[model samples]
Target: MKVLVKLIFLLTMTTPAFAQADFKTEQLKFDRVSAAYEEKWNSLQEALRSAGIGRPFKLYMAAYKAEGKLELWLKTNGQKTHQLFRTYNFCAQSGILGPKVKEGDLQTPEGYYYLNVFNPKSSFHLSLGISYPNQVDRFRSGKEKPGGEIYIHGNCVTVGCIPLTDDKIREVYVLAVEAKNAGQDQIPVHIFPFKMTAGNLNTYLKQFPAHRAFWTNLQTGYAYFEKNHMIPVLSEKSGRYLFK
Candidate 1:
């Protein structure tokens, strides 16, 4: 009987439901995180339900620098494509419309990345760190430091990070937590210098000719998402991004 009980306990511990619950349990231990749950979870869940998106959904975030917009996309119930869930405006903007190259360049990076860090006890209320200086960024930087530590955070202030107001961050942070707890790891966060419409691209290219090559490369990924409303499969080669 003791062996039987131990076997059941081990099985329970390894279940996906158990793992998901453990993730939320760890996050709620933080005071700010707890407060955010208290404030935003109910509404967030209700919004999801209203939109026909059920629990354990996948999340994708996209940020456009020129527009100061952050869009949240959701895919759930084994859906093939993502739907636009919400759009939030950045409370602050930093630098110009270009890819960040070296350290202290004061430019927000433009590329594909995923959320790799969650800071519940963040000094900026709450923050989700993006995987920057990716292979392509590294290749471009060469011998220089490509700069790092980019995040979508709160406090409405930034040098190179995307900042939403505290109230707004609460909503975003809670949604991210729920998605993570639902077993959707590697949440994607794509940043762009601007909406890559052909007109905009041509206009910006003339104004900032130096970034034409880089921006054109970025437009390929942008066009894919615009057409399919789906995440593009990306790979890096020779300091350039190739979208599949």
Candidate 2:
């Protein structure tokens, strides 16, 4: 009886320790990423300063699907307008040029979105979730089956998400995390079909007349940002985007 009681005691004692160890391991996974950010912080700060961006600034991102490019824009504290900072090329393309419509459509969404979550332990190495199925997406694609979980992630491969090379995503993710930690909420990510220049629009019309009206609506927001370096307030009406 004494031996059995001792065995039970041992098992009970060891179980909590095992659980604690597992928890620590999980925590360290995130900690490692934090350490990486800290290590690279100075270099990022230097880049920002060189570009006239100050610390703890607001950030905006624009992705051009046709060009395979992602542009980063920044507005320093006390500044009225954002300035272009850097552009990263998407490493892969998926689906086609249009808003994602269904669960299995394999289409990368085109519209306004924001960073919603950060994942350090992403299977794609690291990732930032985009708020897909936004008001416009749900209105256009229907509420019940609009699909979701779009992300800008590392790994250079994608089904319906933006893929950056692992190195590039690490830089982007680190900068975004720093922006979040510094109190910049709602970092905007505007995904465009292309640059939306008149030339580009003409090309789009010739190739994809079916999508011209929708792309035209997107151009209003695109033009506002290009001319003003500020994001316009967005609203939805009847499944279409209206920019103010």
Candidate 3:
């Protein structure tokens, strides 16, 4: 009787049914989004091919607050470098140029982050959550409140998040899902105050001296990618970003 009980437990734990249940959840999300975006999905594929990028390619995103643009970068499998894929404009903006420090500060965060969640049935149409209040933010904002729930979402409105139009977000969301399905995990999302050009940096420094050091550190990662077309491995030490 004990042997039979153990055998049944092993079977239940190792069966494919458990795995299929998780897969079905992801598939359902894809199907719902695909149903609403069949045409856009087709066009995205064509655009990818035209740009010489293939499906399931790794994706990197960079958002510039001053420019109000989100640039998508892609690299095909086995490639050593990424290429510019598309740029989406922000439909709305909020707060001023700075990192979000508190829960109600109304400031969009500025730093390196990743897409940590997907909202298929978002009230904003569809949303990609950004991993904000990251290591640096936590250290700077303290334990009491560092804010949360930052996202690159749709709805054309924002208090402390990046917003895109409903139609535009569908394209972004689809690309994110396809990349995840393709096994490119940890999609990097870098948010910058501006393009990080020499002139822009100098001007920003003049206007916001307090942020100069932080922005300077961010520029290191920015320059590394600009020169190599590859995302650098980043680490935090003493609340500062150390790019490897």
Candidate 4:
């Protein structure tokens, strides 16, 4: 009878601990990241909903390279489902957002990328981190520094991540989290030089004469999407642009 009682006590004591440990592990499996990029996130939701792109969809993150010429993108589905979230600028190095690689090389990447986590307590407000140094990066840089900590965050100053400032991050983060929680795992993001309308194109051409080649490529991508109303893939084969 005493052994039976002791067994029961041990089981009761250990069960709660085991359960708690499991819960902690699960929580760590996918950390609920923070973002100060709230304003930008909110702007995205408002823009999408107001522009008629709402729930039951995915997310896309686009970042312009420092020169304001090139850009990078990320696609995430069901990002609205997360209870917390934010968008990141894949190519941000200094005062603006852009790509970066080697030390002191302040150029944010321009191409396709992915997200790894949500960082709440970011050096800049709230941040959504991006996965840089993908296949292309590895192949190209070889033994070079494969970039680091690219994010969409608050606090606004970036060495390589997109910064929306704390106020802005808060707005964007909330909407992104909601999007994730809605069951999206892969979101699609398209980055362009400008709005890519006739007027905007003209403005860009007139305003920045040095960026003709860069803007031209950006317009091609934008046009593909404009015609299809969907994110189009861009590639070059035998020196010819391929859009699908």
Candidate 5:
């Protein structure tokens, strides 16, 4: 009877992930990109595997080009939370952050969006789409089209989308799906500058002087999130962020 109980316990512990998502659609993405991103992905996997969040935690990045660099981070637990994880070069040919107001502008949009789906039929390999033309962007641009097609995809090349390389996106895509499956909804993405760490600020200060105001705004949001471990409802009072 004791032996039989041990066998059943082992089977239960080693049961297959039959109910978990099949991220086959995102394979072969994210082989490489920023070392920091890779490291974070591994750590996240280990954490989930250990915590057994009973599901994967969704990941999100708010990519921004400040001082000629592209940076990203991870957000989890639905759209209710976020955390700073890594930074990298813009790697975009066009140059800079903010919406691509017009074609060939070479700028990645800045603001709140969500990773809604994984696109296997992507020109840049696998792609995680951004819900662009968000209300804020719409009001900011005041343009009906304001263009779309933003993504965090494979292939380290960009016109208007982010390139995380085929290998890298594959990895990122899997992580993202895990995060969504874990969180139970679309992942919230808040694209912003390097979040202005003392070091980050000093590093890009020269290249992105115009971005100081933006980065400063992010500092407030970053500080609040860092303290609360939850994404605060940002309220604007005379162009200032007041946690709601």
Candidate 6:
């Protein structure tokens, strides 16, 4: 009876570690993910070390549709600001510059989101799901069905999604897996129509006048991060985004 009790105590003490292990273990069960780790993990780890970021660091991602660029930012655990780590080009483009309004709009959404799913068996090699149609999107759509199933994926083909090509996604997927295994439950992903620099905004506003109001709202968040390199706390109010 004493030995049994001692064994149970040891298992209980290791529960959290086991929980973290389950995520990676299950992910590695997929062939593509295992291959990604085999191909990219060593180089990625070296890059992380050079950046002064270690395992369990936080990740923040941002994408610019017009520029066809995706940027990965990282910060060590307990750090407040994220530093730019790398940039990947979007291998394909979809709809014009604007927020996705309804199902089949073919417009990749623009707004605050997060990685909500990780699919190691993705048809496009591997993919990280984006949580779109959040409260703000629903509020804006009103009666329309805001489209769903957006992702940062591979394959270099898109109807209304960001595609980074198979080779690039392998690197990104590995980094995301490491971050998730480190206990990042909600990895932030912010998508914008374009880099919201004043010059770019002014130029685009003239060509796409209808999106002026919405883009202006997005600029506030962009400017905040541009100045601080920190994610801004945002709230949705009656179909509009308010940054705090």
Regions of candidate 4 where Cα sits further than 4 Å from its true position:
1-54, 65-99, 190-222, 233-244
* Order by lDDT, highest first: 6, 1, 3, 2, 5, 4
Ranking by TM-score: 6, 1, 3, 2, 5, 4
RMSD of 3: 4.2
Residue 218 displacement (Å), model 1: 1.3
Pairs in clash, predicted candidate 1: none
Kindly list the per-residue Cα lDDT of model 2 for residues 97-179, writing each as its tens digit.
88888787888999989999788888888888999987778877864587888999989888899999777887788777766
Q: lDDT per prediction? A: 0.90, 0.84, 0.86, 0.51, 0.59, 0.92
Tens digits of per-residue lDDT for model 6 on 106-133? 9999999999999998888899999998
List runs of model 1 lying over 4 Å from the truth: 1-17
TM-score of each candidate structure, all chains considered together:
0.93, 0.85, 0.88, 0.55, 0.62, 0.94
| lDDT for each residue of candidate 3 in 1-244, tens digit (9 for 90 to 100) | 9999999999998776555345324745665476646747788888998999976689999999999999999999889899999999999999898788889888899999999988877778789999997899898887759889999998998988889888888889888877776666688999999999888999988989999889999999999999999999999878899877
lDDT, candidate 3, equals 0.86
Which of candidates 2 and 3 is the stronger one according to lDDT? 3
lDDT tens string, model 1, 1-244?
9999999998987897787778889999999999999998898888989999877789999999999999999989488788999999999887888888899988888998999999987889899999998998999898999999888888977989999988999889888988898888889999998899999999888889999888899899889888998889988898898987
Judged by lDDT against the true structure, how good is candidate 6? 0.92
Off by over 4 Å in 5: 1-54, 67-93, 97-99, 197-219, 234-243
Error of 3 at 136 (Å): 0.5
Task: Please give, for residues 115-151, the per-residue lDDT of candidate 4 as tens digits.
Answer: 5666655566466666665554455456787666666
Per-residue error (Å), model 3, residue 204: 0.7
Error of 1 at 97 (Å): 1.0
For all candidates, what are the clash counts?
A: 0, 0, 0, 61, 19, 0
For model 5, residues 3-106, the per-residue Cα lDDT tens digits are: 99999998787554433333432332434323324455677567555644424344546565555343334543344554544444444445554344554566
Instruction: Show the lowest summed lDDT stretch of 10 residues, model 4.
Output: 78-87
Against the true structure, candidate 5 has what lDDT?
0.59
